[model samples]
Target: MSDLLIGGAETSTLAALASPVTVIDSTTSCQDVDELFRADEHLGCLAVHGDGPGRSLGLVSRVPFQHLMSGRLGYGKLLNTRRPVSALTDWSPLVVHAATGVAEVARQVLDRGSSQRFSEVLVADPGAPLRQVSVTDVFRALSGELATKALTDALTGLANRDHFLQRLQQCCTAPDVRRRLALVYVDLDGFKAFNDGHGHGVGDLVLQVVADRLRGCFHPGDLVARLGGDEFAAVVQLPAGVPVGPAARQLGERVRACLSGTISLSSIVLPGRASVGVAVASSVLADGETLLREADLAMYRAKAAGGGRVELVTDVGSTAPREQFAPDRRELQRAVDEGEFLVHYQPIVEVGTGRLASVEALVRWQHPRRGLLAPGAFLGAVADAGFAANLDLHVLEVALAQFSRWQRNLGRAAPRAVNVNVSVQGLLHPRLAPAVLDALSRAGLDPAVLRVELPEAATTTQLDVVRGALGTLRAAGVRLTLDDLGAGASSLHHLTRLTLDGVKIDRRFIAGLLDDERDAAVVVMLLELAHSTGIAVTAEGVETRPQLEALQEMARGRPTFVQGHLISRPVAAEEIALPWSGGLHHLHAHVPGPRSAVPTAPGPVASS
Candidate 1:
């Protein structure tokens, strides 16, 4: 039996199936072991113990061991009854360490060939008792759990971004494929606002509803996936000889119509709309990223051109070259060197007393030809040019200097902290911690006076690297926050691992908080989560009195802060007005209701 077993040395001892094994002492006779196997018909194998307690000498299987002892051969009839069970034990049975990976165990099992494929494997430490595992259990768990996690979105139950890209790649690389493929990038226009207004509980339902609508808009063969947040993508095969442009346009129109109607959850009726961008595979060799980018660019164009519309990448009148939209690399570098960038500060006030708490530092580009442009217009270009870190450092330095100036003027009346947006690139930079500490030192400011805001979307990838850098920043006494929580692919999973000072709820939820039950519930949940963890919570985009009043009510017993136009818009450093400074109090007195007070200009600040 020992000689018949193969690859025993290579099998992982840890890979034993988590199942019960029948154990018998090595002193037990073959006939006794046979009787024990007969008593438990479902038992696949038994462990034969050696002289020491809990020490397994080897394993014996029901089938082969029984055949050897049945006296089928002349030798078996004469000697089987008296032979020790150890004679039938598989001494070289497949053994693996407990720490071995499942994949390696499966590979070793398959390598043993079909004869031992279903045989029980021993999972144990050397000199320890053996535990049995089933090969079928390993494959079933791997195929069921790993496969689902890899291919499906856990939230919406649709194909995930990874699965969608893989299928798109397959379609692009299919040999001699003649049919064209269309990629439609759909972004819900006001989803963030909807989520903010209603709450995450209802927001999740909205996403499911959108997913169902999207799934209905296309044929069963088409692939649809939520690319995080309000973004969704679909890849469909176009009929032979059908022009990509017309097919994409027609499909986008159908999707728009399908998603345009109102969705009713409980007693609340929420309106829905999406901006769709269509890109077709120009050739069978086209890359997935390029195709997706083209579609994304078109989606932006649709959004910029007053949203709720579909735009095709191939549309001559609507589509512009990608380079044209992105700022010139030299121009961006010149802006940094020439001091062409400016920082604007927006006040975050306590919901209870409306007292000034902190001001978030937002960046604006003073583009020579483009006038005073928000970061959105050119920050993407800066990021694409690999200057995101440099730009982030510049903003931080300026914000710290300005914060110092504010402290000089206000003395003890200054806001508690000034928040500067930190890009993921900046956080990961080797010099980030040193640079920040130096800035604070030069300004003679405490690390607690300056809070760094990191976008939630940015921290999802390369977490170890992000966490390492963040850990250094935290160690330096610098305050850190996850900005725009619940806006993109925000998850509570991040909150569990990273050390954070606070979380800023994105304005989208605030926009609907007053009238939306879902928004109210989500806000309360976030406040509870933050408060329970000893992390502060700030709500952004509080543009109305009703929203402000409602947030105040929700945050009655908690330490919550609010920021938006209703408090004050982002203004130049010199224009920052705190409640103690008479600026905030004056504005609050004049604004009677929502949309009643008009600001001189729209807020130019953008999230980092």
Candidate 2:
């Protein structure tokens, strides 16, 4: 085989292709070379040189030398068997420099086609002995690596979507008429909420837990795969005596039970549940795509029926229309146009000095009948309607405009930065950078004053696009932060991959800090990680004085920021008071109407 090709063109160099070689001196005899080959049967070729390693005289391959010596008119009869190997060496063998790329070397070798019996290339470096690289080695490595990656999901180490589909197809077309195959589609309940509220890190932990549970619930022969973000599918082969419908239902129930429990992470215990849909192949000629669609529809039905339940494709009662599971797109579009959305600012303060550092921009819906509604009430609806990006942009524009007003009113007393959440859709948008920059330009605010916070889950789903947008933002002098750091499935790996300015410790961990020693330790470790990486740390949900005191103690003189009702409830743009009086004095005078005073003990706080 020839060197690896990219787009039908060879581009690898001999340096990348080279492997350690067995070297022989110029005076080494044929018998000695034969003995060396005998000791290591895998050794295909040998390098012979004079004086030192840099002086390569020629090359000799095992096959050609053996063939020449074994011929009827062989060198054995004309010369001594112990003669120096130089007598049998090819003085003008193909040789390449160590710096030569694979592409050029492949072109030169492959151009000879099958007529040439070359199996390896000799790579030479200045002042060093030649190294041998077998074409077979490169081909095997590349093929094996590509095949493994193509079949596996990098995050969870499970079979990926493509592999799942292929296996499903095989099951549908298998030649056993009496055998049955079942496809179970599992969608996690409240996963988006968990991801959105917490962070992708915690969300990822949930996914990994769900994957492990799903794998444990199935038979060894079954195939399980993560079909992307909180959704999983499995192919189960029914036993000979088992009925397909009953088997599938049993599988689904077992899966739901296994996954519907609490996932313990560090100091937090997150609830987990899944809605499952099952579809069985009816015939050998069953269509894979149709079966998958049926299973998906059944899953949606299970979700619509309040989730945490199993629904089968053959059950007539499970045939709910898809529309019932999704929010109306037109309604969302109308809301965007009718200006039903509002922006709220929640304060983030320095834990030591209690100075106002920044405020995060949160979106709310001023519903005509529902009064003021938080994002949890309608963000999902907007996302389901494929209007999340628009809503995010709208929120950004409103927040930026309001921030400009605040800047004008308070002058130098304005908060250092105004953070706006960027949804996955918004982050992946081609116009995200331009739209953000445009909003800042229109508001006449410097880019440094507008920080973009992304959920951790978004980082894993569309990594390249998110990284690109973040790069553009960082280049523009805008700050970037990872929100809900311990809320969802987050990894320390993200801190290295992403260009982040800071991390917001999830409120749950902060809420647990007073009572949970583990939580306090986790927070301290997170702070250490962030500060060591040159990233700032903000502890969210500091409602109680105990929590604040705990965080302050943990800070150990480091600058830690805290955000929660203990400081101030999220208020309208006009109500934001800046250059905080270095304490909670402002909270005493400007408490929002009809709301309970901030809780003092370790408990839930008003949502930020």
Give Cα-based local distance difference scores for all models.
0.71, 0.70
User: What tens digits encode model 1's per-residue C-alpha lDDT throughout 1-608?
Assistant: 01110111121224445665667888889888878888988888888777754345678888888778765655673577778888777765677776665545655665564566667777776665557787666554433333343355655767777567767756655644414667889998888887998898899889888888876777766778888888999877677677777877898899889999999999988877889998876553334666788889989999999889999865322233222446566767788889888887777778776667888888887777768777666666688787888888888889889888778887888778989998767777888778888889998999888889876656556556767767877887888888876554333556766789999886655765765444454466566667766898999887776777777676766788888777766777655544244233335433322222444235534575
Tell me the spans in candidate 2 whose CA falls farther than 4 Å from its real position: 1-325, 369-371, 577-579, 582-608
Q: How big is the positional error of residue 436 in model 1, measured in Å on the Cα after superposition?
A: 0.2
By TM-score, the best candidate is: 1
Candidates' TM-scores?
A: 0.55, 0.48
| Candidate 2 overall lDDT versus native | 0.70
Error of 2 at 514 (Å): 2.0
- Candidate 2, residue 535: the lDDT equals 89
Give the Å shift of residue 560 in candidate 1. Answer: 1.0
Q: Residue 539 error for model 1, in Å?
A: 0.6
Which TM-score value belongs to model 2?
0.48
lDDT of 1 at 293: 82
